[model samples]
Target: MESHTSVVLSLYRHGVTRENQEKIYIGWTDVPVAEEGIDLLMKTKANRPEAERVISSDLKRCVQSADYLFPEEKKIYHKGLREIHFGDWEGKKADELSKRKDFATWLEDPENMRPENGESFEEFSTRIQESWEMIREWCFQDGVKKIAIVSHGGPIRQLLTLLAPAEKPFWEWKPLHGQGITLYWQDAEAFRRGERCTSLSAVPIMEKENG
Candidate 1:
C-alpha cells in the first residue's frame, strides 16, 4: 500500500467587530473588524503555520482577517462558512434578550429552540457539515495538505467540536477573536472517515515586541 500524507488544518475566528465589543449578536450582520482589531490581526502571522490554501467566510470580518494573516495567498470565500444566522437577534445584546421568554427557552435548549426567523442549532450544524464535506473533497482531489480557515466564533467552535481529537463540549473550545486552533489528521483515510484529528495545538495571535 502507498503511504498517505498527513494534513494540517488551522481554523481561526475573525478579529473583533464593534458589535462584539458591545456584546451584541451580529451573526450575518456583515460588520467589519474594528480598528484595534486590525492591529491584533496583523500579529497572527508571527507563530501561525503556513498554508497551501486559505479559506474564509464571505462576511466582511472574516474576509478581512484572512487577508491580514495571509496577504499574498489567494483565498476562497464561502457563504456556507457563515456564523449562525441570528435573524431577529442579529443586533441585540444578551441583556436585551434576557427578558423574552422565548430567548430563555432557546438558551435552555438551543438544540431544539431557534429564535423566530433564525436558524436552529441543528440547522447551523448541518450547514457547517456541508462546508466540511467540501473541504474534504478539496483535500482528496486537490491533494491539499495544509489549509487555513477564518470564520466567526460559532462556526469555528462547531468545526473544532467536529474535529478535535479529545472530546470537548462546544463551549469549551472557544477561540477568542484573532485566535485559533490547529488540527492534524494522520492520513487521508483518517480525514475521510470523519474521525477526530490525531492531535491539535493552539494558534494564538500574540502581541508584537517593542522595537
Candidate 2:
C-alpha cells in the first residue's frame, strides 16, 4: 500500500430512493434514485471539484448517482461496496420488522444476528473491508491524493468502523443521503476522520436524463 499524508477519501451515500420516500428498507434491491437524488449528486460533484477519481457500488442507485456526477468517464464499480443484504426483509418497513419479537434482539446485537433471509452484520462488514483494501491499492497505484466514492449507507457505515472504530455510536455515524464523510489515510496504515460535510439538502438537483 502506498502511504502518504496527503491521501484523502470522500465517501458519499446514494441519493433518495423510492424506498426512502416510502419509508421501506431497501437492502440490495438495485433501486434507482429519485429525480431529487440526481440533482443532489450533481451538487456534490460541484462541491468537490478537486476529486480526481470517482467510484461507486455496482447497484443501480449508486451507479446512477455516480453517472450523474461524473458522466463523461467510467467509474470504478466494486460489488463489495454494495448495500447490506436484508435477505427476506429486503423491502419491508422498519416499524413492521420492529413489531416482531426478534427485531429488538437483532438490532441490539447486529454483529451476530442475521435476519430471516438477510446478511449478518459481520458479513456486511467483511465485504466493505475487502473494498477498503481495494481502495487502498487503487490509491497507491494511481498516486491519487484525493478521490470520491459514491455508495450505499451500509458500506459507508462499515467503512467508518474500519477508519474510526472508537468515538461515536454506530447510529451516529450513519451517512445520510447525499451526505459525505472525509477520511485521511497516511502511510497506507494510519487512518483518521476528517471534516464531514452535508450538502445534500442544501444543493439543488440538476435535471438531466438518466444514463
Candidate 3:
C-alpha cells in the first residue's frame, strides 16, 4: 500500500513434505518439509528480491521455510494463511480416494460444497480474503512496500481469486511446491476497490530433488 504504487506481494508456497512426495492431500496436516526441500529453499532464496518483511502460515512447513529465507527478520505467522482443511481426508493420497463418490464430486466441483466435514469453498475463500485485508493493513501501517508470504497451495490459490481472477479456478491454479506468484497492484485505492494484479507472474521452482 505504498503511495507511489501497490506493495509487491511475493507469495511463495512451502516446500515438499513427505505427504507431498507421496502425492497426498496434505491440507492443514502440520508436517515439516523434507531435507531436500530445505536445501532447495535455501537455494531458491537467492533467486528472489530482498523482502522488507516476511509472513507465513503457522503450519510447520511454511514456518520453517520463512525462517530459512529471512532468518534475521521479524516473521509473522497466522492461521488464516493455512491450507484448506480436508478434515477426515487430511493425510489421504489422491489415488486412495480416487474411487470415492464424494471425492469425485468434491474434485469435480469444489466451490459449491465442503469436503467431508472440511471447510466449504466459501469458508476457505472468506478466511483468505479476511487474512489478506489484515495483511494489507499491516503493510499500510508499517509502510512496508515489499512483502513476502510463505504459505500452502490452497491459500495461495484462494488468494489468487482476488489477486488474479482470470488466472484460473482454484484447482487449476495448483502452484508447485516452493513456487507462487508475485502480484502487483496500482495503489491503496486499487487494492481497496478490488483491482486484479497488474502483473501476475510465477516464481519458478528449482529443479526437483533427485529422488
Query: Which wins on lDDT, candidate 1 or candidate 3?
Result: 1
**What do the candidate models score in CA lDDT, each in turn?**
0.88, 0.72, 0.81
Predict model 1's lDDT versus the native.
0.88
lDDT ranking of the models? 1, 3, 2
> Each model's TM-score, in the order given?
0.95, 0.80, 0.88
Q: How well is each residue in 1-211 modelled by candidate 2, as lDDT tens digits? A: 3444556677888889878988787888878899877667776666544467888898998888887767776688888888888887778898888887766788887777888888888888877887787776667667677777889887887767556525555556768796576765444434322322212222233345577
Q: Which pairs of residues have clashing backbones in candidate 2?
A: 3-187, 3-188, 39-205, 39-206, 87-117, 87-118
Candidate 2 has its poorest 10 consecutive residues by lDDT at: 192-201
lDDT of each residue in 1-211, candidate 3, tens digit only: 4456666788888988888999888788889999878877876676665689899999999999888777778998899999888887888999998988999998778888588978888898899999999887777777787788999888887788668837677777877676657877767566655667677677654564677
Candidate no. 1 TM-score:
0.95
Top TM-score model: 1
Per-prediction CA RMSD (Å): 1.6, 5.2, 3.1
Better of 2 and 3 by lDDT: 3
lDDT of 3: 0.81
RMSD, candidate 1, Å: 1.6
Report the C-alpha lDDT of model 1 over 17-70, residue by residue, as the tens digit: 989999898889988999978887888777889899999999999999999989
Off by over 4 Å in 3: 165-167, 204-211
Instruction: Let me know the TM-score candidate 3 reaches against the reference structure.
Output: 0.88
